[model samples]
Target: MDEETTEEIMYMTVLGCELAKPNPLRPGVNRSPSYFETLKQCCHLPIMQKEGFYRFLQLYNDSQVVVVDPESSADSIQLTKRVMYLELFKDLQVLCTQPDNVATRELGQRVAAELDVTYGEQVGVQYRKYNKTSDKTRLRFVTEGMLLQLIGDNPTMAGYSCLVLDFYEPTSNVDRLLPLLKKAIGLRCDIQVVILSTKYFEKFALYFDVPHGLTIGGTSFPVGVQHVTKVVADYCETACHTVNQIHQNESPGDILVFLATDIHVDRVVAKLRGAIPDMETFPLYGKLSKAEKAKALRSGDKSRCVITTNFAESSITVEGIVYVVGFNSIGTFNFLDPAKEEVYLRGIKDVNAMNLIDEVGIITPAGKVAATLPIDLTWYNAFNEAIKLGCLSELIDIAALASVKNPIFLRPHKTQHAADSPHGQFTAPLSDHMTELNTLHAYLRTKRNMSTQELATWCNETFLSSEALEEALVLQEDLIEWCKARLGVSEISVLTPDDKDYDVKIRKAITKGFFLHAAIRDDSDQPDQYRTLKEGSHVWIHPNSALGGGDWEWVVYHKIEPTGFQYMDRCTVIEPMWLLENDYFYPLPLTKDYGGKFWLKPLRAIIDAIDSSVPHRIGG
Candidate 1:
C-alpha cells in the first residue's frame, strides 16, 4: 500500500518600529473630508490601512464598484465617519454582520457625538429588539437581518443612496443579499454599495463585475512582532504573566489582552487584578451590558489592562493600547459546517510575547494566504435550502401582509431538484431554528403568561441569552399582529409546557422542518452516535444539549458541527411515528425488524421522488 504526503509551507513577517511623520494638512483649510484625510487625523494607521484608504477613495470617487479590506476596527470606523462627514449621499445605511451590539452602538454614538448631533435624532441604530431610525435620520447602523426586512418592505430601497456593509464574514444572509443589491443598483443609478472586509474582497469585486481592485500597502510605524519557539501549558496563566512583564518593563501605556470567551476574559481579569493590584483591569465581551462595555472603553487615569474576547479585535477600538497579548486562535474556514466559526486557542509558547514599544503588537499566526480563494459552492446551495425550508417564506408573507410594495426576488419557492450533491447538504436548516425559537417564545409568553421581568429572570436562571429571548418575543408579537390584520385571524395556536400534549406538539412542529434531518439511534453504538435517515452520516449529540444524556430512539437536529466526529446541536427527541405521520413529505415505507434491530432504509429515494417545485404551505 502507498500513502501520499503533502508539504507544509509557512510564511511569516515580523514588523519593526518606525519614526512618526508630522501632519501634512494645513490648519483650517477649506477642504472636504475624504476617507484618507479623516482617518489620518483621528489615529495612526498601520502601513496596510493607509494604502487601503487611498485605493478606496480613488475607486469610490470614480463611482466604480469597490470592496475595501480593512485591517482594524479603527480603520472602518474612521472611514465611515469620513463618508458621513462628506455629506455626498442623502441617506447612508451601514449594515453590521456581527452581533456586537456594544460595538455597533458605540459606532453610532461616536459618529453622532463628533457631529454634535443627538444620538437617535440624526444617527440611528437598528437591530433586533431595537429600532431608532426616523425620517430625520441621515445615518443608520443596522444588522444584516434588519436590512433584509427593510428590502422586503421596500424592494427599491427608496431614499437610501448608499449602503455600507461593515464587515465581511461568510454568511447566508450576505449570499442572499448580493442579488437583491445588484437588482436595486440596476433599478436606481444613484445607489452605491461599499463593502468593508478583512477577507473575501476580490470575490466580491468579481461577483459585482468590477475589473480592478485595490490592496493596502504603504510605509508607516512598524509593529514589533515576536513568535514563541515552544508551546506553554496554560494560556490564562501565560497571559497574566505576560501582562505583568509588560507593565513592569514597558512604558506607561494601556495594554490589551485577547482571550477566546467571556469565561477566559473573566479569569484573566481576576488573575491580573490580583497579580498587579495597582493596575486597573477590566473585562469586555459581547454579553456584557451597555454600562459595563462603556466602562471598559472608558479611559481612566490609572494604567489599565483591557481583557476582552476576539470581538475587540475587529469590531472595537480601545484607546491608548500600546501592548497586546493574544493566543493563536485563528479561524480555519471549512466549507461543510461553516457555522462553527470559532477556533480553539493555544498558549504563546514559554516566553513572554509582549511588544516593548509604544506601538501595539500583534502575535498572529504564521500568515494568511494572499491569493483570492474561490467561493465554495456549498454557500449557494445552503441559501437555496433556506428558502425551500420556508425560512424566507414567512418574511415574504409578513411583507405582503403589511402592504410592502412589490416584495420581489425571493418568493416562497421550493426546491427544483431533490437529490443535491452530498457536499452541498446544509448541516443546519434555518427554518427549523426559527420554528424552535417561535415555539419556545410562545411557551414562555403566551402559555405561561410571563411578564417581561419574569421572562428576563427565567432567561437568567436558565443560562440563556436574554437578548436573544427578547428578540424572539418581539418577532412573535409582530408576526401575530401582521396575521391578525391581514388574514383577519384573531389568534394563532401555540402549545405551551402547561398543555397536556406540549412535548408532542412542540416536537412535531420543530421536527416537521427537519424532515430531511431526522436521525435514528444506532444499536451498535453505546450512547452518542446516531445515523441520519437520509445520508446515514454518523453523528453525536452535542455535549451541551439537554438531550445528550437521554436514551432517545429518534431525534431531530437543527445543526451539525463537523469536528472529525459530527456533533448535533439544538437537538430534540421525537417519536418515529411523527415522521411517519407526515409520510407524504417524508416517507418511511420500507422498514425492517430483525432481531430487535429496526432498519429505516433509503430515505433519499423518497426524498428524490417528492415534487418540491410547487410552493408548499409555510405555517398552519
Candidate 2:
C-alpha cells in the first residue's frame, strides 16, 4: 500500500475508536480506553489518561516531546487519526480540553515535575513575587552553570532527553542562548527542543525557521493589568517633600522616590530628614555595597520613604509603593569663564555652557571659552586670553551678538523694565574691558592740554606708568575706531600730544567707574585711617595714587592692593565726585550725588584732598 493509503487506513481505525497498539516509536505509557473516556467529557485529560497517553506520558518519560500537526482533510477519519496521534506527544503538556494557556500554573507544575524527575529531585522552580509579602511570584529559572552541572551529573539524560523552555516572554539574553542550545543538541539528535510562551510564538518560529517541528498551544488570557507610573527628577524632589509633608499631617505608607543619580539620592534623603524630622528616609543607589543593598531591601519598614535612582525602576520590587516621585533635572555645574578664572558657582545652568561656548567661539590660549560670566577660574583666564588675542573683541558681541546655528534664543523681560532683553545683553561697568578703554580716552583728552613736566607730575602722582599710558593711548584710538564701526557711528576720540594731568584724569576715571569700592572708616579720629568695606580690612591710599597722601576729605574707593614685595596693604582712593560733577558717568545716575559723599565721612576726606588741589575742573 502507498503511504497515503496507509495513513487513510490509520485514520479510519482512529475514527472507529480502535485502540492504538503500544509502540516504541510512540515513546509513552499507553492507557486503557476507559481512562481516556473519563477525560473525553471533561475537556481535560484525566491524570491516569495523561499518564497513559503517548503525548502526556512522553512529557514525563522523555525530557522533551515534539508534536507534529497534519493538515486538515475532507476525510474526517484521517484528520482525527493524525490529530489523536499528534495530541499524544505534544511538546507542551497542554490540557486535552483547552490546550492554549501554555504558561499557566498547571503547565508550570507539569514542567517542574518533569524537570525534577529527569534531572533529579534537586531541581526547583523559582517565581518572582507580585506582592511584597509573597515569595514566589515571578518565575526565574536556574543559571546556565547550574543547568550544565545537572546535565553533567545525569550524563545519560543529556543526549537522551531535552529540557522544556517555558516563559511568558523571551528576554534579549534568551535570544542569544537559543542558537547555542541548538548547537549543543546537534551532538545528540535524540534531544528534542520545546519552547512554550503565551506570546512571541511567531518570532520564536521564525528564529527556529523550521516546518511542523514547532508546536504551539492555545493563547494566554490577560492577567490583572497594572499601570506603570513614571517619576521624573522634578517630580521626585517635589513628591519627596510633599509625601513627607503628607506623612506629617496624615498616616504614612511606603513612599518611593526616583532620582537620576546617587548624588540626588543623597540630597533627597538629607532634605527629607531636615524637613520631616520624624519620618525615616533611606537611599538606594547602584554604588551601594551588596550587603548594604540587601539590608535596604530587607528593611521591612512600614512607614519609610526610599529615595533611589533608576535602579529601582524595574529591578527589585518593593512593597506598598502607593506614591512615586521623580526628579527631572540632572544637576550639573555652571562656569563663568571657560578658562576657569573666577566662577560664579551654581547648580546646573539654564543652558549647557561648554557645548554652547565651543559651538560659538574658538578656544583661547588657556583652552577656555569667553563668556560674560566665568563659570570657573579657567573660563575667566580664557576670556582674558581671548581678549588679548583679539579673538574676542567684546563680551557682549561674543555672548549676545555672535551668530549661532540652531540656537536656543531666550528673551527674558527685565523685572525693572517692561521691555524684553536678549540674553547676555546687560554689560558690567568696571568688569568690562570697555570701561578701561574709556578711562584711557578721557585721560589722553586731558593730557593734550598739559605740558610734558605737568604730564609727568600727574603720572607720578597717580602712580600711572607714562610708557604704558602712551601704549594704551595708541591702542585706545584703534579701539575707539573699532567701536565706531561696530556702533555705526562716524568720527572717534583720540589722545593729544602734550596734555598734563592726563594720568590724574585716568586715575579719577578709574575711581569714578568703580565708586562702589568706597572705604568705611575704622576710626573717625585717626587720619589716613580707612578700611575698604568690600575688603573688610584696614587700608590706606595706595602709594600709586597721585593723591595717596594729599589728605582728601572724601575719596572714591576703587581697589585694594595687597602687600606684594614692594607695595604694602593700601587702597587706591580716586576722586569719584570729580567725575560725577563733570558728567563723565555713562548710563548716568539718577542723582549727581548718588552715594552721598558728605555722609561718607571716610570717603569724604579723600575727595576733599583732590578738590583742594585743583578747582575741580568740569572737563578738559
Candidate 3:
C-alpha cells in the first residue's frame, strides 16, 4: 500500500502484443506492467477490523512521474462497504451516513463505472443488505459513523492509504473523532483524504487547513415548492386530501407524500386508498423490503404515491415525482429546554452552555403540575433499577436503542395491525422500554445461529426492520464495547432469573435518573398527555413510541422534544413517591414549594454539579 512499492517506469522499450493482422504496440511505443490482476485477490482482506492487512494495487495510477515520452503514460485505477454492514473494501474506504443517500451513492457508482483504467476491478456501494461490491472492487463506500469505529479500532487507519468522507455533514460523532482523524493524517502524510459535500463548511478549515478546494455545481433540475395556506389538524388526512387534489387538478405524474414516520406513511396510504382508489401506493423507508423500494422507484404508472419520511428529500430519488406534499407533523424539533440539555446533546462546555441560553427557568405550558419528566425520568429509573437488579449492560442496550431514531420493530399501517401482531410477544404490559428489552434479549439469543438472510426474513415476519435491527445490534455492541473499554468489564451478568425484586429495582432506577422529569397522567385532559413536575409543560407521548398506547398515571422521561405537541418519547410508568422517598432526590421538596404542588426541581443543583465534569461518551 505504500507509494514506494512500485518502481517508476523510466525507459521502457516497445513490447508489442501478438495480433492477427497488426501488432498492438508501435516500434517506439513504450509499455509498462499491469499488476491489477494480481491485486484482485487481496481485495477480500477485512481491512476494517484487522491490523497490518494492506491490499496493494498500483493499477490505480500507472503514470505518476513526468515520463520522457508522451506515449509512456502511467496506468490508472479506482470501491465499497456499509460501516455497520461489516463488509470489506480493497484500498480506499468511504464513510457515509444516509442509507438511501442518493448523492453519495451516485458519486460512488459513477466513480466505480468511470474508472476505465483500473485493471481487474470496478467501484461499488455497500449499505444495509445491499452489496454491489466484489473482490475486484478497489474503492469501497461506507458510512462516516462506521468509519469512526474503524478509526477508533485502528487510530492510524493503517490498512487503507486513503479515506474519503463522501457527502460529509457536521455531526457530534464527527466532532468527537475528527481530532483522531487529523492526528492520523498528520502522522501518515501519504494518506490522502478527499472530503466531498454539496455545500462547503468554513468551520472545516479548523482541522483541514487546505488553501485550495474543489467545488462542483449540482446537476439537479429546479423543484417547485408549494406551501399550504393553513396547516390542517390531521396531517395524514390532509396529506391524503392534498395528494387527491394534486392528482385531480395538476399534471398527471408520481406524487411523493412526506410524512413523519412509517405509521403515518401507512395511515396516509390507507386514507389515499379511500380518497383515490385507483392510485397505487407504496411505503418507502430504510427498513422496507427491496420489493417495496422497487415499487416506489418504478415509474410508467399514470399516477402513484409513495408515502415516506424526509428520507426522500436528499437520499433516494423517485422517478416521475411531479408533486411533493411536505408534512413533518410527527417530527420533533429541538430538545434543549435547559442549558444542561445542550451540555448533553452537543457535548458543550457547561460554562458555555449557560451563555447559550438565558437564566435557567421552567415555564409550564398549562397551569397543571405533576411530579417528573416523561422520557428522562423513565430512563433514569430504568438505569437505576438495572444497576440494582444487576442488568446494567442490558439497560445500556435498551437505553442506546431508545437514544437513536431508528426503530427495531416496524409500525404497521392503521389497517394492517395483523402484520404487527408478532411484536405482541416482545410487548411488556406496562413499559415499552421493557418490551424493547424483551425484544433485544430475544434477538441476541436468536442472533447466535441466525444467518443474515434468515435474520432479514425473521425481521420481516416479525414486522421489524432487519436494517434497524442491524443498526440496533451495532449500537448494542458499541455500548458493550465501551463498557469493556471504559467501565472495564469483560462480561456483565444478566439479572438473576429467580430475583422477583429485579422488576422493582428497574422501577427504582427510573425514579433515580428522572427525579426531575417525572409527571402524572392528566386525567382531566388526555391520558396520553402529562403535566410535568418541575415545569408545568403538558407533554404528550409520541405516537410512534411503544409506551404511547399505555395509560400510565405517573410517568418520567429524559427530555421533551419541542415539536407540534412537545412529545415525551421514552416514557416509563413511575410511582409518585419514588421521587420524595428517594435519598438523592429527597431534597426536591425543600427546593421550593409551588402552591403546595409536589414536584422535583433538583435539576438546577444536579446540573451545576455535573457542569464541572465532562459528559461520558462511548468513544468511536
Candidate 4:
C-alpha cells in the first residue's frame, strides 16, 4: 500500500479498534512494551502526527489514561475527548512522594527554587505535608490575591519563583480546586504548572496533554508476583465476577481495587482480612483523615492490599498496582428537569461506560495485569436468592433492574429473618421523658404556635438541653429544605419557631418527613401501656430529630426509608424509599400477601399513601 493509503487505513482502523483491550501488540499479555512502542510509532506517521495524535499517544502511554472509544457517536466522542484532554493537561505532574521527610522536602525546595527563577516572584509557592504527630496535614501557599503583596513587601525576591509541592495528592480540598487552578493559571501568565509524585509519570501521562518526558529515578521491582497464588478463597459473590477472579488470580503488588464507596472498601477489607490474615490491608477513602490516608499510601508494607474509592483512580498514583478491581458505579446528582419543573435525584445520566472501563486499567498502569473483580455479581446472586425466598417482589424487581442498569452486586443473605424482614424492630424502650417531650413539642407547634426559641424553652422544660434542641432544629431545617427540593416545591413558607403552634408544626413535620423510619416502642407484654408496644419492626428516628430522644410511636402509616447516611444501623426503619427509588432502586409492582396488617398492602401502595399524604409535589 502507498504511504497515504497505509496512514489512512491505520487511522480509520484505530477509530474502530478497542482502546482498552490488552496492549494490542502483546495479545494475551496485559502489559507489553512493544504495544506502547507501536502506538508511538503509529503516532509519528504523517497523517497521525498532529496535536490530536500527540494526545492519543499521551493517553496511550499513561497507564492511567482513559481513551474514549472512537466508535462512540460523534457527540459523545467529542465531549469525552475534551474532558479527558483537559484533565490530562491540568497537572503536568503530581508528586505522591512524602514531603515531610528530608529527601522529599529538599526535592520540593529545589523545585521551588527552580520555579521561582523561571516564573518570577509573583508566582505562588506552597507545600503540603502530613503532620504525623497531630494526625493532620496543612496546605500553606502564597494566596493568589496576596502573591503580588508578598513580592511587593520584599523587592529582593523580585525574580524569585514559586512552586507548590503536595507530598500526597491534595485529596480533600484539592479535588474541588482544579477549576480554581485553571482560573488562576489563565489569569496569571507567569505561573508554571509542576507536580511531583512517586507515580507521577504514569498519572501525569494519563491526564497530561502537553509535551512531557518521564524519568525513572530509583529502581523498584514490581512487588509480590508470587503472592498471586494465594488469592482469597471466598470469591466476592457480587454481580461483577471480574473482581473475584482477579483477586483470586492477582499477582502480589499488581492489583488495585477501586470501589465506589468507603463502606464497600471497609467491607471488602474486612472480608479479605478474615480470609487472609497474613495479607496487609490498606483502605483509601474520604472518611479517613488525610494523615490516615497518606499513611495508608506511603506505608508500602509488602503483601499489602489496598481497597479505596476513586482515590487511586487518576488524582494520585501508587506504585506496584498492576491489576484493578473496579466496582462499576457512578455518582448521583439532584437534577431539575426544566420542562417538567420538577427535581429528582438521578445518576450522572451520560457517563461514558468506556471511560469507566478504562479507569480500572488506567490506575493499574500498562504492562500490569488489569483484572476486574465481579463485586456486582454477588449482588446479583443475592437478589436472585431473595427472589427465590419470596422476600419482596418489588425488591426483586428493583434488584433485577439495578443488575442490568448499574454495576452493583446484592449483599449475600445474612439470616432468614434478617433477610426476609423489610424493617427490623428495635428492642429498646422509649424513655418517659422522650414521650412527654415529643407530645409537648407537637402540641406547641399545633396549638400554641410557638417560635423556635419558644420551642427550645419547651424542650428545656421537658429536660432536653438547649444546645441539643438548637442542633436538632438545625438538622430539622436542613432535612425540610432537602425534602422540599426533592419534591420540587419552590415556595417554602412554613411557620416560624416563634409562632404559637410552631412546636407542634415542627414535630409533625419531623414525623411526616421521617415517617418511613418510625420505630416501635419497646413495650414488653403490656399492649395498653403508652410507648410500650412490642419492638416489632422499629426504625430509630434520626438522633438529630427532636423526637429521636428515644420516643417511639405506632404511626397510622409508613413510608420507605432514605439512603446515603454514613452511620445508620441496619434494620432501622426502612430508609425513606424515595431516596433510593429516585436514584438507585427501581420500583416494580407486585401482588403478594404480606402477613402483618401493614404487610397486607403492597409495598408500593404503602409508599404511595405516605407520599400522597405528605402534601408535596413530584418532579418528572
Candidate 5:
C-alpha cells in the first residue's frame, strides 16, 4: 500500500486510540514524597499486659478487678483480650472521656465507626440520644455518662462481661461512678473493671488495689520538635504567619493548629483565609455545629487547615495533617466557689493543685458546714454547681428510669432542697443560660412555622445547632414525662421569652444558683470594668456577651473565661435587689455589717461609691 494510504488505514483501524496517546508531562506537577503519606502504620510497639490480662482472665468470678496501663496503651491491650476471649466475654463495654475532660458524645461514634470496619456488627456505639448496640454486639463504646446510666439501670452490669475506662480523666461522672462500681462489685462478682490513663494510672491502680499493672510505651511517629526561642505576644498572628509559610513553601498536606480558645480558633481561621486564599480553612470547637466540624475532617481538593482548641489534641485525629503548631500554655478558668473569696483552679494531682481549698463548705442536716470531697475539691465544686443548675435532678430522674436510687442526698447540700426547688411549677430550676437554651429549643420546635430547610437556615444564621436543638427537645420531653410520673405535678409549663415575668424569674433563678458569681460594674478606673462580688478583682465582660458594652449596675455570670484575665461569660442582667434575696446563701456586701471594711459595703452604698469615684464629664 502507499504510505499515506497505509497511515489512513491505521487511523481508521484505531479510531479511538488517539485518546490513549501519552500526554506531555506537566512540569512541577508531580508531588514530592509526603512525610505523612510515606508513614506506615502507627509506630507503637505492642507491649503485652500479661499480668493484668491474666488477672482479668482469672477474675471470672471476681467483680472487683483492675487493669492499668500507664502509657494509656490499655486501648490495644483490652481490645486484644476482647478479640481473644470473645466466647468467654460476650461483650466488652469501653467508656471513653474526651481530653477536655467532658463526657463526649462524638467519641463513641468515631470509635465505633473505626471498629465496625473490622468487627462489623460486633462493634457498636451507645449515646444519650442514640444507641447502636444490640444483643449481637460484642464490643461497645459508650460515653462516660452512658456508663453511669448503665450502672444506675443495671447495677450488676449483667449484660457486659467487662468494662474499661479509656483515657480516664477524673471527671465528676467518672469519680461518682468509681465508688458505685465498687459497691456493684460487692453485690455481683462477675464483671471486670479496667482503668486506663497516661498520668493517673498509678493513682487509680492504688485506689482500685491493683498492685500489678503494665506500662506500655506510647506510640509515636518520627516527629521533629521545634520550640520558639522567644515568646510572641500575639499568638494568633504568629500562628497564621507560620501556617502561611508552610502552605506556600511546603508540599500538599493538611495543617493542624492548636489554639487556646474558640475565639483564637476563629481568629486564626479568618487570618489564614486572607493570607492563604487557595487553602481551605475550618474551625473545630465544642460548640461548633456538626456540619462545621465535618468540614474539617472532609477530604477536599485543596490543601486544608484545621484550627481547633486543645480538645483536638486527644479527642480528634484529622487525616493528612503534616504540620502541627501547638501552644503550650492553656487558659485556666474557675467556676463558682461555694465559699466566698476562694477559687479552685486546678485538679488535685499529688502536690500540683493550685488555689487548693483543703476545707469545703456544705450544708448538712445538722447545720454543719465544713467537709472535704472524697475525690477532690474541684470535682466537689463541679457537683455543687451541677446541683444548683438542676443537672443533678435531671441525672437522678434519668437514673430513676434504670431503677437506680437518687444520688443527690449522698453529697452534703449547700442549700436546703436544692434538687427539690420548684421554679414556676417545674420541679427543677435550670440555670438562666440553660433555661434560655431550652426556651429557644421549645419555641423553634413547636411555635415556629418553618420547613426543615428554613429551620436549618435559621439555626445556621444564629450559630446554633439544629441537631442539638432537636436533641434538647427530646430530652425536655423525657424530663417532663418523668416529672409528671414521679413528682405528681398536675400542671407543667414551659417558660419562654414571651412570658410576662420571664426576665424576672430567670434572673432570680440565676441569682439562686450563681449568687457567688455576681459582678458589679465599677468603671472608675476604666471605661468598662467589672469586679467579682467577693474578691473585688477587676473582670471584663466577654466581648460576645449581650451586656459586653452596656452599663448595667449588677450582673450575674455563669462562667469565667479560661484566659489570663477574668472575663465574665454568659452574663445575665439582674436587679440589685435579687442579690439581697439570696443573702442566706452567700453574704452580699452589707452596709450594716461592714465595720470599716472597704469591700464589705452594701449594694446601694457600693453603687454610690462607684458613682462618686467616676470623673464627672463637664460637657458631652
Candidate 6:
C-alpha cells in the first residue's frame, strides 16, 4: 500500500477577549423595544488590555484576528486603512473592505488616484468591472460582501496576506463571519484578519477558542449633549418633537435626526417641511441615488436639517451637524422564519434566529455556506427557489438589490412635486411592487436605444435614478451569469409582468421564497391596516406607498420596517390561496371561515389536501 500524501492544515491560534452571545429567546417581545431599550441589553465585548493587538502582530507575523478599537470613529477606519496600506504596500499583499459598497468604491478610487497607479493598476471597483486590473494588483478595497464571495471560491483567500474588514455589525456581519474565519484559519494559518469593530471581539475570541484578541486605540471627538426632559417612546413622534424643538428654538446649526426607516425619515422630513418652510431639509437613506444622497451631504447650507435612518450613523459626515438627534434603534435585519411562518415584524431582536436553521439541527451545510457569505437565509432560499423555478435569471437581480442598504426605488419627499408627478404614470393603485416592476421594465425597454445619454435623460424626466437603474441592470446580468455557472443550467428565463404567465411566475416565486412577509387585510372596515399572516400584527401600508389606501386583501411586500409601526412597502396583490398553500404555514386558518373572495373557493383545495393526508379513525 502506498502512503497517502495530503494537505497539512495549521489552525490560527486565538487570544483572549470574551463576548457573550445574547440569547435569541431572551430579547423581550414587550411591544417592539425602543432603540435605547435594545442597546442597553448589549454587552461591551471587552478585550483584556489595550496593548494586546501589538502582541499578536509580533508573534504571528501573518495572523487574522478581530480588530477592536473602542474609541475609533468612522474617520479612524479610513485613516487605519490608509496608514496600513502605506506601511505594508512594499512587501505584503493587502486588501481592505467596508460594509457599504459605495464607500468601498469611493475609497478604492481615491487610493488608486492618490497612489498614481493607472486607476485599476493597484486598486479596483466592481460593477465598474471593466476598470479592474491584472493579478499583480496588491491592495484591493471592496465591500465585505464582495470579498466574501471571492473567499467562498478560494478558501485559502488566495493572493492576499492581510485582510482588513471595514466595519462590523453584530448580528449580520460579525456573527456570521466568525465561524467561517475559524474554519479558514484551520485551513490556512498564514492569512491575517484585521477586524475594525467598536466591540464584539469577545464573541470572536470565544468562538475561535482563542485567548482574548488584540485591542488597538484610536482618537475620539468631543461633543456636547442635551436631552429633552420629556420621554417619547415612538421613534417617529420623538423625531418630530425633537425636530420641532430644534427648528423653532435652537441656535444656528445643522440638525441630524436618526429615525428607523426610510419611510419614517420621509415622514419626519414632511412634518419639518411644513413646520419650517424656510429651513433646508434633506432626507438621507439607502434608497436615495448617489446624486440624491449628495444633496443631503452638501456643505453650502450652514444649518440644514437631515432626516435619516441609521445609514448616516457612521458612513456619512455632514460638517455642520452640530445637533445629532440619534436613535439607538436599528432595523438592521428584516427576518422571517420559513419553517414557522413568523415575520419578526420589522426587526429581529433575536439575532440568533436571523440565520436559517431547523428546530432540531445545529448548522446544516447550507447554513454553514450562508454563515460564510454575507447574504441572508431569505436570499439563500430565494436563489434556491429560483433555481427550482428556472427563474434564476431575474430573481438573483431582485435578491441582490434587496440585500443592499440601497433599495432600488427612491422616495422623493412630497414637497418635490416634480418627482411625485412623474411617479403617477408608473403607479398601479393596487400594487407598489407592480409599479416599481413596471418602472424597471420601462427603463429596460429604453436600453434598446443603446445610448447612455438617452437613458439618462429618460431617467431624469421619469423621476428614476439613472445610476440606480444602471446598477440594477448590471447586477442582474452578473447574478444570472453566476447562477447559471453554479447551478449548471444552460439558460434561465427572466420573468416579467408583460409575459403571459409572468404575474403567476413572479408571485409564486415570491410566495415560495418570502411567504413569511405575507399579510391579509382584515375583513372589517379598516382599509389602511393589514394583519401579517405569520405574526398577526396590524401594520399599515406606508403613506409613501402608491397603495397607501390599502385596498388589496392579500399582499406580499419586499420589506416591513418597524419604527412606531410595522410599515409595509413594495407590496403587490396576490390571491389568498398563496398563503393557504405555503408549506411553512400549512393547515392555517383563513381570515374567512366558509367564504373567501370570488376567486377563492373558501380555500377548499387546502382543506381537502389536509384531510386526504390523514387516515380516518374507525372509532374515537
Q: Best candidate per TM-score, number?
A: 6
Q: Write the per-residue lDDT of candidate 1 for residues 449-556, one digit (tens) a residue.
A: 787778656543333444444444555455445445533445454334376754454455555545556787776646867887655667887654456557677787
Tell me how candidate 2 scores on lDDT.
0.38
On lDDT, the stronger of 2 and 5 is 5
lDDT tens string, model 5, 248-365?
Answer: 8877788999988776787788778777889999887666545557788897999988998755644655767788998774552211113233223312211121122232423332
* Model 2 collision count: 61
Each model's lDDT comes to 0.54, 0.38, 0.53, 0.34, 0.52, 0.58
Query: Which runs in model 6 stand beyond 4 Å of their true positions?
Result: 1-66, 70-79, 82-91, 114-118, 127-131, 199-221, 235-252, 274-279, 330-404, 414-417, 427-431, 486-488, 494-502, 544-550, 578-586, 589-620
Give the winner by lDDT.
6
Better of 1 and 5 by lDDT: 1
For model 4, state the Cα shift of residue 496 in Å.
13
The order of the candidates by lDDT, greatest first, is 6, 1, 3, 5, 2, 4
**What is the Cα root-mean-square deviation between model 5 and the actual structure?**
17.0
Query: Counting only residues 3 or more apart in sequence or on different chains, how many pairs clash (N, Cα, C under 3 Å) in candidate 4?
Result: 73
| Model 5 C-alpha lDDT versus the unseen true structure | 0.52
Tens-place lDDT digits, model 2, residues 135-215:
211222333322333344554334223444532244433543565665656566555555543334455555555433333
Give, for candidate 1, the lowest lDDT window spanning 10 residues. Answer: 7-16
Q: Which runs in model 5 stand beyond 4 Å of their true positions?
A: 1-123, 153-156, 182-189, 199-220, 231-234, 241-253, 299-303, 332-454, 478-488, 494-500, 525-528, 583-596, 599-620
Taking the tens digit of each residue's C-alpha lDDT, what string does model 4 give over 1-620? 65555544444445433243452222354534543454443333322334454344343334222222221112121222222222222332221222222223333343333222111121122321112211111112332222222333543222222223231333323332333444544545544343333333344334434345333221232333223334444334341245445556765553467665655666676676676655566677543433446655664545666777655543345555566554332332212112232211111111111122232333322112111111122222222222233322222222222212111111221222332222111111322212323432453353357777776555433333333233234333443343244323344343433567433332333332233333333345433212201123433333322234433333312222232332222112223333223211123222233653432223444457546754243331
Candidate 3 structure, TM-score to reference: 0.62
C-alpha TM-score for every candidate = 0.59, 0.24, 0.62, 0.31, 0.65, 0.72
Model 5, residue 437: displacement in angstroms?
5.0
Better model by TM-score: candidate 2 vs candidate 4: 4
**508: Cα error in model 5, Å:** 2.2
